[model samples]
Target: MEVNIEIPSHFLCPISLQLMRDPVTISTGITFDRDFIEKWLFSCNKTICPVTKQPLDDDLSFVITPNHTLRRLIQSWCTLHASYGVERIPTPTQPPTITHSNISKLISDASKSPQQLRYTCLQRIRSSIAPATTRYYSSRCKNIIVTCGGIQYVANVLIEKDATRREKEEAVFILAQMDGYDQEFKSVVLRNDDYADLFIDSLVGLLSSESSSNRERENAIKVMKMVYSVADPTRLGSVEHEMFAHIVRVLRDKVSKEATKNALKLVVELNPWGRNRVKAVGSGAVHVLVELLLDERLDRRISELALVVLDQLCGCAEGRADLVGHGAGLAVVSKKILRVSHVASDRAIRILSSISRYVGTAKVVGEMMEVGVVAKLCLVIQVDCSSKTKERAKEMLRLHSRVWKNSPCIPPHLISSYPTN
Candidate 1:
């Protein structure tokens, strides 16, 4: 016999609207499933209790006491309805505790004593950077770290003159991971001009440090990328020239594939500002991008990013000069069209269009013909490409067909596709 048992409305979590498992009570006396409430408080950063509408604690150290009574009642009800296919709820594991008081004491002692205890605390938190595969300790420790000024403490480790290089690297990596969890912490850190300056300076310094390992450079670039993700245009535009300089240096140095990719993205994001475009160009960004585009083994994503940056850089005269100055620049840009993804092809066309429209002197247009740029544009028209890309390609072809249509570089097969004068 099959029976559908109706779950009692009162036993449902207010947020999930599902039958409550491991119910827990917050200070507002409202009950919710443990997972749902924790997600609400920690993940969603909601300050108010869901049902009661009362403001919860600001520090995220507020306790969520397990409602053993309600949990047992739900379990018993599930058992009673077992015949109807309702499985009994197993005993839930106890939630991890956030010892705010203990963390605060540790931070205070570390600041005052500055000895073995501080190092030990840092080591413990440092080890907690592992992902929360199953052990919730890392997540719990991070919560404790943030609520008890442990985040600031960790950031301070980077600023500590006495801290070893390894210590600073570890601290930077830890804060970078923590940056993923809490937007509140990010906002708080960025709001303080002193902390934000120290944070950025620490990353830039570590990246450029002679003693900094490849791993350290990779981690620093990753953290800087994450920080830039949350920054507004004004803040992004206001970033220091040294920042842009080192970012280009990272790309130029090719510290690691991941670091290069991040630097490319950072360049793309920051180049919208006139000052940034000028600074990045002066930092030899256009030259590095042209070289990146010429890499035979470049990943599609990196290629796409490079072309996008190139497309932006070409907006300035110096950027265009650098692109044209490279022997392989026009050829590489032409090669990527229709060979990579749609975005890549679009950017490549845009780059060509920029040169043809703004910077195409007779020698430049002749180089375009020599490099098979005209042939690639003709190919774009014959293939299945986006309308916008095809239009741009056609535009580039028509703009220069008088000079390039009869060139020996154009394949006989693609000549018919080129627009007439």
Candidate 2:
């Protein structure tokens, strides 16, 4: 007869509910399997204890101590139950604990080492340390890494001509993960014109590189967005055309939703300075944004961002011409007026307002009338949209009343609310 052996509930991990292979106790005084807790804390980007529901420190120094006593008990239980087909649990080997001092040394050694060793060190920093430290404990680790000169080391790797492809990718990945958390660091980079230019040039090179992987491109764009957010006005005004081209390419390729959103945001950020609007128009941003909005399945946030970019771009003559020139541009912008969120509606109205106010030639006004944009504006006046939006709609109607008023395109119900001014 076979004997059934019941496992003790206390011997199980709180998270996995399996026999603990390598039990570890968290700061909350709760024991869980090491793998399970690490996954919760690092992989899931969480900082709370699963069982206790207490907030864990957002510090990399927060330690998960090994529960050797519980591990031994679980091992004994498995050993005693060997007859019931339970295999003896082997003792788990602890990984070397990573410390700030060791990380600093590693970065220092890599800084002075040959290319191969440098790559290896960067790989370790990216794969092992950077993700865990930067993802959750950004505020804490940002100061530490910045103090260790990690940022400069990584930037050097990116600008080094002899650096291998993997080395550059890893460097960008680490820099992207950092995400410009330290504003002081950003100020310092911006103050040094040469360093800032070289760093940005390397990131743009990644964006424009055909050999770059999708992940690499995504990270590079993220870093670029962060860098440009705090860039000085002079630096923003001088943004290279190639950078805009690559950003538009990222938008067209739709590398990922995050990448697309960041690219749109980058365009919006840069458009306010110098000839960036023209550069974006030259890079085909208007067409790409219009095409993106035409997709019915695009999420609300992306739609809003796309419209926002279009609104900024439409501030310039080149932008207005490009938007009106695209086949679906006016139609899509009109369609989003009251259909998406308030922000989207606001931006959409602003785009039309720009076209009507500055570029409202007879032909363009007719295009707006034919595309049902006139109807949408009429509807906007009667609807419960923002007062600002309603005013803009009325202004557009009043601007082109001679052509759009009493036009057959305006729905009869909406024509009554059309601005008579």
Best by lDDT: 2
Write model 1 residue lDDT over 1-421, tens digit each, in one string. 1446788887999999988877888878888998788667644446688887776543222356789999889999988888888887889654444477756766786677564344545644664445542356677777878877787787778777787665687677777677555475576557667778777888889988888888788888887887777777767889877887888878888888988888888788788888888888888888888887778898999999999999998998888888888888898999998788989999999999999998889999998988878888888898888899899888888887788878899989887888775
Q: What C-alpha lDDT does candidate 1 achieve relative to the native structure?
A: 0.79
Model 1, position 213, has a per-residue lDDT of: 85
lDDT of 2 by residue, 1-421 (tens): 1246677898889899887888888767888887787667653546577887776643222366778888788888777877778887778653424457756876776676644256645654664445544444544555566677777777788888898787798888887777656585485456589888888888888988888889999999988898888887888899988899999999999999889988888887898874988888898989999988999999899999999889989988899999888888898999998898889999999999999999999889999999999988888887788999999989999988999887999888887888777
What TM-score would every model get versus the actual structure?
0.71, 0.76
Clashes by residue pair, model 1: none
After superposition, the stretches of candidate 1 with alpha carbons farther than 4 Å from their true spots are 1-109, 131-144
- Listed per candidate, the RMSD to the true structure in angstroms reads 12.2, 10.3
When summed lDDT is taken over every stretch of 10 residues in candidate 2, the lowest stretch is 55-64
